[model samples]
Structure formats: structure tokens, C-alpha cells
Target chain A: MTRLLPVLTVLLAIVALWYAAVAPMNIRQALDMAERGGAVVVPEGSRVRSETSVWTLMAQNTGEIARGYALDRPRLPTPVQVGAELWKTTGEMALRGRAFSTRSLIYHGWITLQSTLFGFALGTAIGILGAVGIVYSRTMEMSVMPWAIISQTVPIVALAPMIIVLSSQLGIEERAVPKAIISAYLCFFPVLVGMVKGLRSPSREQLDLLRTYNAGGFASFLKLRLPASVPYLFTSLKIGVAAALVGTIVGELPTGAISGLGARILIGDQFGTPLAIWAALFAAAILAGALVTLIGWLQGLAMRRMGVRA
Target chain B: MDIEDVVVASDLSLTFKTADGPVHALKDVNLTINKGDFVSFIGPSGCGKTTFLRCVAALEMPTGGTLTVNGMSPDAARKARAYGYVFQAAGLYPWRTIAGNIRLPLEIMGYSKAEMGERVDRVLELVELSGFGGKFPWQLSGGMQQRASIARALAFDADILLMDEPFGALDEIVRDRLNEELLSLWDRTGKTIGFVTHSIPEAVYLSTKIVVMSPRPGRITDVIESPLPKERPLDIRDSREFIEVAHRVRDGLRAGHGDEL
Candidate 1:
């Protein structure tokens, strides 16, 4: 709850900014557009035309002025028009299920969320296990680690489409599996490096204490190594979740047909109405922020339970 | 009990396999510590005093020689929960509360829940930390932390205690208080103690027997028996007998210094 305060404050500020800048300005832009018979005109060298509201003024140009307005450029969405459109669309697309309803966003969001979680979990597990394996065994360090580093350098963004096609070719028919795999690919590296560092975090002196107690391999690892890794694990998991979300979003962008927030975004994007695109983008941002906040809360709870202050 | 000697080290030797060379840390060292014996081993920096204590605690294995306490090897003795070791640092688990830190060995040794609670209470009281069980290690002064660590070791009710410069990290006033408290605790419980310290005054103030040693291939130089009365006062340090023994320890150290080369 304490953590939510800052986020809420930031959100309120953004809302205020929208009210101040986009809300009134976009309404004025729309009014001016409607006034000028839906074509914008910028009276030359007007100081008001030179500010951030320049885009709004440019839409007022007869044909060839302002940054975003042109005979060809997509219209700058006024705050009122977007708000009204958002309200109307929420009624049509979200609340009442008109064209491209928010119910679809919810459904796609659920699918994306499930894949993100699964992929993040799978990646963290793999990374932790791999880190443990590498830390304990010099042989694995020589043989497996370099290849793992090399694997990450390959552009997963480019390979995601190939992975989808390849998964089908191999008769792995799960629709979300390919996307989840790509998310997994994005997540595991941070976990790998972070877990390795965490697992090895126990100082030489702490290990010496265990040694004095005759604590053998597994005993020392469980009592000391594992507990120490917790903070690192949660931190990595937070990063991993964000990366997984990114990977899933990226995965959706390439396919252009899958069911996800990302797919919804791509669909809304091509239509040229910034409101639809902005809504999708805003929803995705909210989801990522919430997910990160959840991980952060867990981190605090675990650290507190372990008697760690921070 | 035919033998009240709780610790017996015979011809102990250790050679470390270092990259630079085989470092001979200890050679043919022998010592016997009886029940309630406050024995301190003091030496130069690279001397085997700490190493010897470690060997006795089974933290380090001897390259040669046999060591036992209460007729058992240190490792076997440790498994039986026979000794509490206080390291140079408090070695308190930073994440555990004071009482929780004290309870660690008891937990490891598998005491009943009730027994563990009783034991923790007693040790916390023993160290004069009657009400500080909930505080973390960082919250305490260095002396208090070390005392808490000693309390942790004392919680086990082991027949033997090993302390490696436990007071070395403390300032003078706290160290003096702890030394007095330790002596009183020793007088009360009759637990055999094997302590390692570099501080001359600490050794003189605490030990029944001081084993003086020196560096290059470390070896015991002299075993000085302190004759100060059992009922020690802070002013006892100013006594002639105490002064004599302190002088003897200094001379022995000087001799050991010469013997090193």
C-alpha cells in the first residue's frame, strides 16, 4: 500500500498533464479543425504556433505547415476527442462490446498474462538451476556457459517468427507455446547472471562458519547459499517478468495475428486513430507496472520475513 | 571421572599446501586443559595460536598428531555438541535476532522445543543480555555483540569452549567488563576454555595458564602459570604477582622473537 502511493501520485500527475496539455489543447485543436472545415491553418510566426502545441497549430496549416499535420499525416488527437472517443469506445469496444471491444482486450490480456507468467517462471527456474550448476561445477563453466552467453546474442525478436513456424513444423501445436518460449528466452539471462552472483554471495567467513560446524555440501547450500540467493532471485524475477512481457509483446508484433494485448496494439496501430493505439499502449504499460509492483511487494515481504531490512 | 582434562592435544602439526610454498604453521605442539581451565594461547602474527585453537575446535584439521577432548576427537566431539566456539568476530548471523542466533546450535543439535527455549533464556541471562533477544546484531555495540556470540556458544551447554580473540575486537572498557564476566561465568560453570589472543593484558587478566608462542614455523615457547587469586578484583592487575607474570609473558615473547629467526 505504501508502495502504491508513489505510483498513484505519478499516475495522477500524468492525468493532470493530460488535462492541462492534451485535454484542453486537443479539444481546441479539434474545435479549430472543425471550425476550419476539418483542415488546419497555422498563421505564420505566431509564438503559440512555436511551442509544444505546435503540432496542434500545424494541423491548422492550409496544407504544408506544423510538425504532424499535412495532406498525408495522421490527425493529432485532441484531448476531448480522445477522451470522448475513449469513453465511446469504452462503451462500444470495452463496456458494451462494439467493434474491437475491451472484452477482447481482457481476453487477449489474460492470454498474454498467462504466457508472460509461465515464461517468466520457466526462465527463472532454468536460470537458477543453471547458475547453481555452473557455480558448483568448473566443468560446466568451461563447457556450457559460453554457449549460453552466445545464445542470448542471437536476435530473439527476429527469430520469434521462425520459432512459431518451427514449433508448428515439429507438431508442437500449442498456440501460446512459441510466444512463451520467446519470453523465456528474454527472461532467463538476467536470472542466470543474478542467480549466479546471489548463490555465491555468502562471504568467505560465513562459509567458514558452516565448515566449522561440519556442514556438508547440501547443508551449507540450503542454509546459507539458498537464503542469500533470495533477494537476488526476486530482483531478477522482477526484471524477468518485464522482459517476458516485452518478449511476448515483440512476439505478437511479428506474427500480426495472435491473440494478445500486443496483437490488439498492432491491429489498432495500422488504423491511424492514435486513441486506439494509445489505449492499447496505456493498458500494456499499466499491466507491466502492476506486475513489477507485485514482484517488488513480494521482495519486501520475503526480505522482512528473513529479517533483512532492505 | 579419572581424567578431568577436557582437552588434550598431542604433538599437533600442520603444513599448508600454499602456491608459494608449503607453509608450516604449527609443529609438535602439545597442551592439556583441565575442566574450568582458562587457558590462553598468545603469539606473533603468523604464530600457530589461532591455528591451534582452530584445530582444537575442528575448524582446521591437523596435518599430524592426535587431539581429543573428553576422550573424543574434535569432530566427533562437535557432533555430540561438546563445545562452543567464539570466533574473532561475533560471527552472529546478521539476519537472526540475538535470541534466534543463540538458538541456532540448539536447533542444529536437535533439542526439544521447550529445552531450546529454556537453554536460550539461560544463556542470554548468562551473558548479562537479559532482555536483548529481539535486537539484531547490527543494533548492538561490538562488545555486546561478542558477548551475545559467547552467549550463543554457551547456550549449547557444551563441556568445552573455544574462543579466538573474542575480546580482540572490543575496546578496553567493554573488554575488561567481559573479561570479568567471563571469569565469573567460568567460576560458576566450570566449563573448560581454550582461548587465543594476541593481547598480553587480556591473557594475563583471563588465563589460568598462558601458552606463549612465536612465528616462523610456530611453536610453543613457554607455559606460564598465573598465580593471581581466584577471587579477582580489577585492582588485582596492579598487584606484584600479576606484574611478575605480565613481565614473564613479555620476556617469553621477546625470547620467542629471537627463537623465530
Candidate 2:
């Protein structure tokens, strides 16, 4: 991390230069025609700008801006305009119930979180049980494993609407179970693969040692295999939680409802509220980060309990 | 406990069929271990010595003959908890503390908690590892870890012990000291032991009887009774009697390695 600091700074400097350079060329070219014989090189309907600011340059730098104004786009939004939008939209949303209250985001976020937690729980149990079955039985390894892979191959986003509609037909619409099922579908495969590998991870020499003790299959698993698998299981669980959250949000989109991060985005688009969209996106990300961190904490606790050298 | 024949293997043999054909691992291997006998099996690599020890410990099935311990089949004897085994490597569970590892067999055998506590202390002290019980296996040196493994084998006070090159990975100094200590412990506890090694000097120094094995279709080459006195010390290696037995084991190994020339 110490060595990464200079690299990050260099990257930031390059980004800043690119932000400063691109729009100046667009704005300079736009006004160059108004100066003398310079034909309006930029197409009509492209926003006409007077002066180029460093921050505004970033927004206008897209190649589409160079072609004559046919590709009509908003002029580089001044930082003040963005800031003003952030304040007004956030302020109105906050003041809906009380001053500085984000009741809408809170309620919708709670709904999404409920679905994520439910889905994550379901997925973890299914994955662990599936992995155990696969490792212990040849029939499961041959039959269930291929089906698990096939299930993952179907794009979940494409299946989300079908799942939602089917679940509504089956009367799970108001229960959050549909979103949870979708989350479970997305989160289980990694945990399943990781756990099977972890359970079977102990070396052959170790197994022979256990055999020397006359330990049976169950005793061997309890004494050695289970303890050895703690690290891999927890790592997969953390990743599974994040996937569960993403799946829940995707699940919300198919439902076409007004809740969760997905719902917030939909509402923002319906009302032309970019501020709402950005705030909702930030909130969803923060939620996912929090859930993943929680699993990481659980992982540390589990490894310590198993007496494994971290 | 009365001192008597602790193990008797009668014409034991093992074979397995592989992709190529049937492979014979051990042939007509027979040995007897009486109480307090520190019997050593010495041979070159691929001599099937380790496999023979595993058979006595009930870890492998003998395809041809019977292995009896105190007049019971190895499988029944194992269920009766008649012996403890130490492997070529320590094989200590990295997740367990040394004390916990020592108690594993006791735990499986349903020994009382108090009994386990007492036996853990006794064996740890026997191996001169009195204060190292709480440390995890990974935290210990190779020699110390092997010592812990030996202590684990002795934890239940079984009548017989099987060790497969248990100290082969240790330094010479540690190995010599451990051999002396092991002999003293045997004399004190009167536990019959079957030890396997490849070093001629180690075999000559440690054994009451040595069963030499030949490879490539492993079979017994010779069973030589050591001429060294029942009592052994560090200086025994310098004694004339020790050198005679060492030379005999060397000749036995040569014949086993297929260099009659």
C-alpha cells in the first residue's frame, strides 16, 4: 500500500489533465466559427458554451461533442450546478418527514436489506449442504454438480422478470421471498465450489494419520476436515453476501416496484432526478460494503474459534 | 502388566492390482514382539517396512496371512485400543495444540477427562516435553513435534507401540538423545515397540531385534538379534559389540539392496 501512493497520485494527475484539456478544444472550436471565417465545426444542437472550466471540461470531452451539433448533449455541467443539484435534491428528500431525514432511502434500503439477508441465509445453507453432498456421494457429484453449473449459465438478469412474475402467480409477491430466491440463485455457486474444495483440502498424509487412529468417517471430518475448511468457507460467504445484495436489487427491477436501490433509480428516472439516482447508487454501494465487512468479521471469529493459525 | 508376546505376525503378505498388473508389496513377512522389546525394521527405501508397520497398526489389510496382537486380530485389537502408532512424519494436526493432539486417541476411546489430563502430563513428561503442551504443533521444531507425536502414541498406555521412522526427520544429536530416552521409557513402562528405520547405526544402537527387508517385491532378508547389552547408553555406539551388530546390519542391507558382489 505504501508503494501504491505515488502510482495513485500519478493516475490522478493524468485524469486531471485529461479533464482540463478535452472540453477546451470543444469550446474553443465552437466559438472559433463566431470569430471570423471559421465555419461552425461543431454540429447544431450541441450545447454552445462560452468558457471552459476544468471540471466542466470533463463532461464535454466525449468524442460525440466534436461532431457538428447533431449529437445533441447537455453542455459540460458546471461543478456549481452539480453541487446545487446535489444540495436541492438531497435537501428535499431529507426534509420530507423532518429536516435532514432520508426516510425514503431508509425505508427502501431496509426493504432491500431484508431481502438480501434472507437470500444470503438461504444461499449459504443451500451451498454448504450441496457441497457436502457432492463431496460425500458420487451420485451427487455426477448429477447435481452439472445442474448447478447449468443453472448459473442462464443469465439471472434475463430470468429476473420471469422469476418475479412466476412468484407473483404463486402468491409470494408481498413476502420478499421472490427477491430472496433470486439472491440465493446468484450467491450459491461460489460458496458451493469453495466449500467442496475446502472440505476435501486436507492432504492424503493427514488422512492416513487419522486412519492410523482408527477414526471413522464422521470422526475424521469432525477432527480434521471441518477445521481445515474454515478459511475457505468464510471467504466464500463474504463474496456470497455481496452477490446476494446485487441479486436482490436486480430482483426489485423485475417487480417494477417503488422500493429498494433499484426502485429509487426507477423513481429518479421517472421524475428526471439525477441527484436521487446518484444518492441511491451511493447508498446501495455502502450497504453492500457493510454486508461484506460483516461477513469478514464473522470469518475472523470462526477461524479463531477453530484454533487455526490465521 | 505381565511381560509376554505382544504381537505375532504369521507369514503376512500384501498385494494390489494396478493398471499394469498385480504388484506384490510384502511377502512372507513374519515377526514377533515380546513385552519391552524395542524391535527395529531396517532396510533401504521401497522395502515395504512402513507398509508392514501400518498392517500391525490395523491401518492396512494383509492380503495373505494373519496378524495377531495379544491373540486378537489387528482389527479387533484396534477396536480394543491395544496400540498407538507414530508415523515417519509427525503428522500432528496443525489446528490442535500439542496437549490436544495427545488427547485425541483418549478422546476417541472415551477416556474420562481427568484420566486424559493425567495421561497427557505423564506422557509429555516421558518425552521430556513437560512445559510445551499448550503450544500448537506448527510452533514446535521438527524434533519437538516428533517428540509430541511419540507422546501422543504413548498417551493411552497401550501395550504395544508402532513407530515408522518417527525420528528420521530429526537432527542426529536429537535423534541419538531421543533413542536413549525411548529405550529408558520402554524399560520403565515395559511397552512392546516395533520401530522402522533405514540407518544401520540407528538400528544397531536402538533395537533388541532387527528385521531387515529387501525391496522390489519386498520380503524379509534377515532377522538379526543385536549383540549389544540389554542396557544401552550414548557411548554404546563406540563399544565393540555395537560395531559388530552395525557391520552385520550393513551386510544385511547390501544383500537387501541386491549387490551380492
lDDT of candidates 1 onward, in order: 0.79, 0.79
Strongest candidate by DockQ: 2
Regions of model 2 farther than 4 Å from truth: A1-41, A46-103, A269-275, A305-310, B1-3, B259-261
Q: Tell me each candidate's i-RMS in Å.
A: 2.3, 2.2
Best by TM-score: 2
lDDT of 2 by residue, B55-91 (tens): 8877889999878887888888887778888887888
Model 1, B1-261: lDDT tens per residue? 238878888898999999998988999888888888899999889889989888877778999988886888888876666788888888787778899888877766668999988998898999899899988888889999999989988887677888988888778898899999999999988888988998888899888999999887888899988888788877888989988999999999999898646
Residues A133-155, model 1: lDDT tens digits: 99999998788789889978999
lDDT string for model 2 (A1-310, tens) is 8879999999889766754544544454434433344444333332544434523633544443443221122133323343454555445566665433444566677888999999999999999999989988999999999999999999998998888888889877574888899999989988998899999999876887676667888888888888787788888888899989999988887567766778887777677665566667767887999998888888778766656677
Q: Candidate 2 — what's its lDDT?
A: 0.79
Which regions of candidate 1 deviate over 4 angstroms? A1-94, A97-104, A138-144, A268-278, B259-261
